[model samples]
Target: MIYRSFLRPILFRLSPEAAHELALDSLSFFLGAAPIRKAVAARHRGWPLGPIKRFGLEFANPIGLAAGFDKNGTAAESLAALGFGFIEVGTVTSEPQSGNEKPRLFRLASDHALINRLGFNNRGAAQLAENVRRRPPDCVLGVNIGKSHRVAIADAIPDYLTSFTAVYDVADYIAINISSPNTPNLRELQRREPLAELLRALQERNDELAKDKSLRQKKPLLVKIAPDLSEADLEAIIEVALNANVAGIIATNTTVSRDNLHASPAEVQACGEGGLSGAPLRSRSNEVISLIHRLTEGGLPIVGVGGVFTAVNAWDKICAGASLVQLYTGFIYEGPNVAKKINQGVADILRREGFKSLDDAIGCSAK
Candidate 1:
């Protein structure tokens, strides 16, 4: 309430990207100390209906800060203190990237949306690993990896492998991102053969690393997909993931489609060539989650992202079949307290709806 009523308007005065950086920088700077993190967490703590166990890891709550917020893994502790059950950082590549031209991020205030073609800008995987190791979050941390902008589609496997190995140890789980619309030819990797090959290669490496490092088990591996996929495309992906023995799937990244927008064509056209995220992404994201859940028969865990601004929105995703939900544009619009409110609300909803646990609510609406 405070942020939207006052701080957001002030932050809104800046360019979208500038506001993002300023907010992130301010939070990290103020909460950088260990004692500060502990104090903040205590103050803003949210009650979860029950601990959520997914992909061989236990999440303190089911609400997580989605990837791209902390692209370099630099502010995990500060972000966690704001009440995210988990934090996913990066869409990191094998090498560092400056990303596309400035003004890459834009706001559609009327529609409560954002359009971004930032192209996975980050300080690269090695740096993210170093930051994570230096200041690990108090909650589960997942690292999302993508193809370096300069890496060709043909050499993507090696590129991803490099990043995969770099953050493998630091991340509690790893999310393979092949869905960002900003990068050229990146979505091509989502095709059946390419997707299968990539997952197989990474899984093989996962095994080798576990044995090589003499760890008890390999890390959980997940894939993030775009919300714009066709049902056939999703079915193909499910087959590939199951065949490759991947751990989970993150449904519905940002969308290229501009359907159901309140923004004028002129206003939207002015912000050309970027993925649209926020309220417009809700239905499609839930649709994908439902289909995947039904197709997989609840065998695979899913991390849902898209249009999650309120507990009702999060609950809709949960009912549709998401095992966990994430926030991005919602975090921007709803402010820092978004996670705490959503978490408590979900817990309340669970008790009201007669669910014994969060797991009972999963896929309940998938008829």
Candidate 2:
């Protein structure tokens, strides 16, 4: 209520990207002090519902801050103090790039959505690793990697491998992002042959690196997919994912589609050529999570993300088969308290629904 009634009005007045940077910078400064960070964490951390164990890591809660929110790993610890169980940072490319031209991020206020073509902009993988090393988050950390813009589609595997190697030692898991619409031809990597090859190569490296480091467990690998795939495409991608032995699937990135929005067509079209995310993406993302759960028979772990804005939205995804739910656009609209509120709501709902644990509630709606 405070955020929406007071803070949001002032923050929303600035351009979307500018507001985002300002928020991040403010969090970084205020939370940079250890004592202040701890105080904030104490106040906001959700109740101690049982921890969620997925991909060999135990999450304090199922709600995570999705990738793209902290593209450079800056303010990650601050974000964690805000109550996210985990923080997936980066979509960091192997090379540093300025990204698409300015005015690339647009807000469809009426729709409570955003459209962005910010093309994997970051300080590059090496710098991100350094950032994480210097100020690791308070919770689990997943590093999301993408092919460098300069890298050709054909050379994507090696490009991704470079990033994977850089962040491997620090990340709790790695998210292979082949789905951002902002990057030209990136989604094409989702095609069966290429997708399979990419996952297989990454898995092989994961094994080698684990062995070389003498780590007891290999780092989990997850693939993030686009929301625009056809049924057949989804099925094929699932087959490839299973074949590659990846640990999990992040059921969505964002959508290129702009259907059924409350915003004027002209207003939306003006934001042109970018991925759309937020309230408009909820149903389709839930549908994709349900389909993956049904198809895999709940065999593969799923991280559901899209338009999640409240606890009910997160619960919908959990019941649709997502073992964990993440938020990006939702965090923007709902404010910093979103994760703590959602986590508490989920625990309440679990008991109300007569479920003993979250795992027990997974896919209840689908069943």
Candidate 3:
């Protein structure tokens, strides 16, 4: 009520990226105190949805802040105070980057969507690891890693491994991002042979790190794929993920397709080429999640994301087979209370449907 009616309008006046930075900065400054975060989390508390364990990490709720929101781990603890079960920060690379250019993020207000060609802009894995170590969030933290923009396709494995090893200790789980259409030739790594080889090398490194640290098990490794994949592409990725023994799949990143949007082609085209996210991405993302669930036969955990704004949207993804649900654009459009709202609504929906637990609700709609 407050966000859409009051705050959103003021924030909307600023450029999307500017508004985001302001909001994050405000949260970082204001909620930096532990006492304040406790109060905020208390105020935002919803139905007792309880903790959810997936990929060996336990989430306070199923809703998480998807990667790309906090490209660096700054403000994570403050954001965690708002009630996210977990937060996935970065598409960080081994090397730091400034990303595409000015006006790279555009809003399609009518569609409640955003198009971004930010190109994995961040302070690099080492810096993010340091920030996270200094002021880690209260909830689970998943660090998302990608190939460096300067790195070539042939060298992707080593490039990714650089980031993989950098954030290994700080991250609760690691998400390997081979999707995002923003980076040039990055998606080529998603091809079967390359994808398999990459995951294999990373897992081997994961094993070594666990042993070195005297940890009982290697940290969870998850793959974040794209929505535009064909069935064949999805199958090959899934097969590779399972064979590599990854912890889970993020189901989607963002889409290059501009189809089926309420925004006119002229309006969308004006934003130029980039990955489209938010409401326009919901259907395809859900389809991908359902397909991954079916392909894995409930064996591999899936994180469903894209276009999730409310409880109903979250419930839809939960039904479609997401063990965990995440949102990026939805958080942008909805405001600070989005996570609490979705969490509350999901609990209500679960009760109305008489499900034993969230696990029972998983894949209920997939066929």
TM-score of each prediction: 0.99, 0.99, 0.98
Regions of model 3 farther than 4 Å from truth: none
Runs off by more than 4 Å, candidate 1 = none
* Residue-level lDDT tens digits of model 2 in 139-247: 9999999988888999999999999999999899999999999888999999999999998889999999999999999999999999999999999999999999889
Q: Record all residue pairs in model 1 with backbone atoms less than 3 Å apart, i.e. clashing.
A: none
Among the numbered candidates, top lDDT falls to 2
Ranking by TM-score: 2, 1, 3
Residue 207 in model 3: lDDT: 92
Which candidate, 1 or 2, has the higher lDDT? 2
lDDT tens readout by residue for model 1, 260-343: 899999999999999999999999999999999999999898899999999999999999999999989999999989999999
lDDT order, best first, reads 2, 1, 3
Q: Using lDDT as the measure, name the better of candidate 1 and candidate 3.
A: 1
lDDT score for residue 358 of model 3: 94
Q: Over the full model, what C-alpha lDDT does candidate 1 score relative to the true structure?
A: 0.93
Local distance difference test, candidate 3: 0.92
Query: Which residue pairs in candidate 3 have backbone atoms (N, alpha carbon, C) closer than 3 angstroms, thus clashing?
Result: none
